[model samples]
Each structure stands twice: as structure tokens, then as C-alpha cells.
Target: MSAPYVLVLYYSRHGATAEMARQIARGVEQAGLEARLRTVPAVSAECETVAPAIPEHGAIYATLDDLKHCSGLALGSPTRFGNMAAPLKYFLDGTSGLWLTGELVGKPAGVFTSTSSLHGGQETTLLSMLLPLLHHGMLLLGLPYSQNALLETRGGGTPYGPSHHAGADGKRALDEHEISLCRALGQRLAETAKRLENNRG
Candidate 1:
């Protein structure tokens, strides 16, 4: 069997969320677990439009098997009207098979998001992602106040999950606090998953 890994799955339109995923993956590795990065294709309203099977750049599209076999998961996306982006949501909606089979039950999971403004519904977006994970019976993880970055973040950090304030143009880079919280979440999930696996053994 393949060694266990944490899946860092996200949909990034402006690259900010993608950067956060990278930081989270670093944290996952820091906790002695492999991090598998995956992304979903963009959704389109036009009936005739179709995304290529392979992405031209960045991470490849995630398959249900990715989620099925992951030891843990970190879900990230850019905020869309106080919720997750359409592409991420659309991809998740297709996971009914996993949900029915409980493939993700007991796995540690966390959420993160980037917003165009400081109050651009970061918390709501994070919560939106949590709903599906909850249904899948995953153990949800979040940054605690014990993390100094959660207390001192000037850009974006929350107990719900890590967040980034990308400004109106959506070009702002993630500040130190935001990055720290993202890594912290990743580390927490990895550690929790390891603990759960050990307990099961």
C-alpha cells in the first residue's frame, strides 16, 4: 500500500489561495507526512465550453480517489460572495460516492480561503467549505488562539481557518501572519491524523 498523505486541495483564481496551499503543504511535511497538492478545473456557464483534461499549469485536477485515500485534507479557495468558489463547490458536489461510502470518515480536515477584501466573507467561505466535510464525517481542525499568529494577524487569520486579505485587485501577497496560520493548520491536521492512525492501530 502507498504511504499515507495529506491532500491539499484548492481552487485558486488569483494565486493567493494557491500560495497558502503551498505553505500548508510545507507544514504537512514538517509534521512528517507527505502533502499531495491538487486543484480543480474552473467552471463555466457556457454550455459549449469545456476545460482541457490536463491543466496547462499548476496542480493537476483532483480525482475522487485522491480524497478517498488521503490521510487528511486541507481545502482552500478564494472567497466568492461569502462562500467557496464555484469550481471547488462543483468538484465537491461530485463526491457523493465518497460520502455514501464514508471514505473520508474520521480523517482530519481543515479549511482556508483568500478574499479580495479584509471583510470579504472569509469566515463565511471557510464555514461553507466545512459543511461538506462535516457530512463526510471528517474531524475538523482549526487554528487555536494558542497560535500567536491568530492573535496578531493584521491581514487574515481566524479560529475557523486561515485566511488571506488579497485587497480589492486581488494581487496582495499573503503576509507573515496569514502564512503562519496556514502552516499551523496543515501541521495540526497532519499531527491529528497521525494520532488517529496510531490509535486505530
Candidate 2:
């Protein structure tokens, strides 16, 4: 079997969500697991075609197979009117095969998002990402109150998952609390995956 890996998949137009993915990946690795960070191609307003396979920089493209095979998932996206971005949604829409085969059933999953404003629908975007995972029967995981950062974060952490605020200019860095929460979420997910793998064996 493949070594256990947590897939940190995200779509970031302005790089805010991408940073969250990196933090989440750091947390995943901290918990003694591999973090496979991936991103989807952007869908242009001009047509239905996918963006180029190789991005200019950063992570490589994600395939449906990656999502299907992951031991745990950390999904992040930029907010689009209180929901996940179109590209992420579009990519997930093609996962009906995995859903039908129950390939993801009982696997742990979590969601994250980056918003341009304080009230930019962070929770809503997180929920939106969870909907498809729910259909695939993945066990949803969230950062619980045990992580003090959730209570202390003035910018981004949430019970749904780890999040960040990019500010209107789209350049706000990840604060300490946000980083803690992301790591907390990652550790939580890796622990859950290990426990589940053990239980099934």
C-alpha cells in the first residue's frame, strides 16, 4: 500500500488560500505523515477549457485519482460570494466515480478557505466544500475547541476548519493564531487517519 498521505488540495486565485494549504501541509507533516499539496486548473470566463497543466509556480495539478486515494483531505479555496471558488467546485463535480464506488467512505476530511474580508463567508465556503465529501461518505473532521487558537483568532480560524484572511489587497499574511489552527487541524486529521487505519486493520 502507498504510505499514508494527506492530500491538501486548494484553489487560490490571489495566493491567500495557497498559503493556507502550505500551513495545513506543515501541520500534516508535523504529525508524522506526508502532505501532498495539489491545486486545480483555473476555469476562465471565456470557456469551459481547463487552464494549462503546468502552473507558473507552486504545486502541480491534482487529479480525481488523488482525491480518491488520499488517506485524509484538507481542502482550501478562496471565497466566492460565501462559497468555494468555481474551479474547485468544477473539479469536484467530476468525482462522481469515486462517490459511486465509495472509494472515500470513512476517510477523514476537512475544509478551509481564505476570504478578502472579515465577513467574507468563511464558514459558508467551508460548508460548501464539505457537501461533496459528505456525498462520498468521508468522515468530516473539524478543529475542536480544544485548540485554543479557535477561540483566540480574530482573523480566520473556525470550527469548520483552518482559515485565513487575505485582506482587501489580497496580501495579508497568515497570523500566528491562523498558523496554529491550521497545524491543529492537520494534526487532528492525521491522528484521525491513523486511528481509522488501525481500526480497519
User: What stretches of model 2 exceed 4 Å from their correct place?
Assistant: none
Global lDDT of model 2: 0.90
The 10-residue segment of model 1 with minimum total lDDT is 43-52
TM-score of each: 0.97, 0.97
Superposition-based RMSD of candidate 2 using all C-alpha atoms, in angstroms: 1.0
lDDT of 1 at 123: 95
State the lDDT of candidate 2 residue by residue for 110-198, as single tens digits.
Answer: 99998989998999999999999899899999988988989989999899998898899999999999999988888888889988888
lDDT score of residue 105 within candidate 1: 93
Give the poorly placed runs of model 1, Cα more than 4 Å off: none
Model 2: worst 10 consecutive residues (lDDT sum): 44-53
